[model samples]
Target: MSLEKKDEHDHEGWMEERDLTAVEERYLAILMWLDKRLRLVDYLELLEDMYYKVNLQMPKSHTEQYGLDNKFWYWYPLYALGSFSTLAYLIAAVSGALLGFYYAPAAAASAGDPTVAYTSVTSIMVDLNFGYMLRSIHRWSAQVMTAAVFLHMLRVYFTGAYKEPRELNWIIGIVLISMTMVFGYTGYLLPWNQLSYWAGQIGVEMALSIPLAGEWVAQLMFGGFTLTQATLQRMYILHVFFLPFLVTALIAVHIGIVWMQGIAEPH
Candidate 1:
């Protein structure tokens, strides 16, 4: 028999010796099949290594270092804001992705009927099943994320957690907050409603007031000095494509740094 056949025969023999149940035997067979193609074992080993490094190298917090052993602490709840914001962000991302399955970005219209974007949104809310609930969850989660992130920033500032060793993370946090605002603004304009149109106008003016780069900023961000189809397209791209990847990457780095350095405690 060939080496391949020999190996397969050996695997079968090993399994038969174990007297495995039907489910266990099928599971092993599938595991071997996938492992042959995917090299999943190597990745699992790497993940295991990373898990140990995280657990072993993570520094103790002030309370842990001194063994305060207090049942409750005032600042403990404030420390949870960062995690709470992360949870909210995850909820928004998942709901937004589901919403994307039914949303359209086009803004074509005859005169003053309704843009394709608005119609799609209305259809989702009124026609599609459970669509309203999904949209509400996405909107509320985004709002909660914004509030939580703002409060987290304030907590960091008041606690002096932005100093020295954590300065880079602090800067990253600021960038994240700014991007969160951008995310909210882009999503707000997606519906193409009356309020969104005026909001887009405000954004155009703000972009155009940026000293030397005003016109360039306005053109790049809003596609022109006016709010047209291009403006909506730009907002859609920024909200769905650019911002999510950038923000998620930044968040991973931010959380990884915090994990490595340990959460900064108030002095």
Candidate 2:
């Protein structure tokens, strides 16, 4: 190999070809100097390669397989339920995160009249600026998500979209629906108002009715077969922390499967 002086290489000629501004010239000069020392561009290319390699590959739908000529295959209204539920889930997540800043999970106030949890809810609804709207949005989004998920399941069932290779997603859908119900229930109990209190009591009783692990389920879930500070804490944790991660993961899988199977052509 011939010994070559790198200073003989003409980077200025390369820059001159593009007619860069003074600012761009300085930026490129600094970048080139740093890149010569640290090889940043090589690392960036590696990252870009990895990104493209790992990118999701969505499956083609029936319409795409044949042609855009098959417009009848891509019905918008009923097929939109999946996307609608996803949108509602996003709305609930954002509003719930904002509501979390002001929420306390204690079951009772110092005076023991209204529970601390209930007081916090009242404060969010009545005192904090735009808190009512924030909470309303959260509540409504959750409700809408639930309704949309249920309707989506019904749509899939009636259309026989759950058959053949789609059975796994159908099972996952059942789990997601159950998790959604639990999400709502946990959030419902967080307020610790009279209705919530009775609701928790009912939950305890229902858990205790399970044959084998009845008492264990009651203790684990309801905090010793009775509603208390622990109950509220548990509910808050499940609602804000556990269920979010679980539901979000299931949602990602559900969407991924749909992307693969392409919304099971209407039967």
Candidate 3:
């Protein structure tokens, strides 16, 4: 028997035998080189198998499975409300990030006057280029997201889509809705205008109205009893950093669970 290994199974030889084009030959050569050293082909084959298996097991759409044609549904628009809300959230996040670049949380510079934070917002809206439009887009998107989320909840409730297997998703939806409101409320205070100031005041009052830990909640959230620099800073951080991360993670998990559970069909 020969001590040297045979080159009969050489990938280059195989490519030549198959009469591959120049590009295909180069691609195959590199792929074979990588596969020989890394055994990537086996993993790729496993992934492909899994992909096909998942596709095969995927559930058919209700209309397609039931062969229901020409059956226009009234609630079909409501079905898309969740997706619309998600889109709005994404828009708000992007615009809010851009707005954050121009906004200042300092309220000390003009203490008796409007406030540094308020002035910063005025500058953004009136002085900076396209800043007004950016803020408008962010505000509108946030409003739209809140509205969509509310409607989505109502749709889910009336449709009885929160039964049995979907109860966890329903709870997740509720959490997301609450987070969405928080996101809006926090962002609303970043401007530090009269409206923003009063809203923050109301928030403090609401927190203080809670039973035993009311004062603690107010302190933790608003950073004391008054809407001072601390309050603006806290709101800015919540709007631009904390709530964004938390809400985004929760939204992703909520959507992922919904995807896995599949859309509930009307009976």
TM-scores across all candidates? Answer: 0.77, 0.75, 0.79
Query: How does residue 266 of candidate 1 score in lDDT?
Result: 59
Per-residue lDDT over 170-258 for candidate 1, one digit per residue giving the tens place of the 0 to 100 score: 99999999999999999999999999999999999999999999999999999999999999999999999999999999999999999
lDDT of each: 0.92, 0.89, 0.87
**Superposition error at 80 for model 1 (Å):** 1.1
Q: Which residue pairs in model 2 clash with each other?
A: none
Q: Looking at model 2, which ten-residue stretch has the lowest summed lDDT?
A: 67-76
Report clash pairs, candidate 1.
none
User: For model 1, where is the 10-residue window of minimal lDDT?
Assistant: 66-75
Instruction: Give me the candidate number with maximum TM-score.
Output: 3
Give per-residue lDDT, candidate 3, residue 28.
Answer: 84
How many angstroms is residue 37 displaced in model 2 relative to the true structure, after the best TM-score fit?
A: 19
Report RMSD for candidate 2. Answer: 6.2
lDDT of 3 by residue, 28-121 (tens): 8788889889999899999999999888866678766886533426567888999999999989888988988888899776755778888888
lDDT tens digits, residue span 70-104, model 2: 45446667789999999999999999999999999
Off by over 4 Å in 2: 1-61, 64-74
Which 10 successive residues of model 3 have the least lDDT summed? 67-76
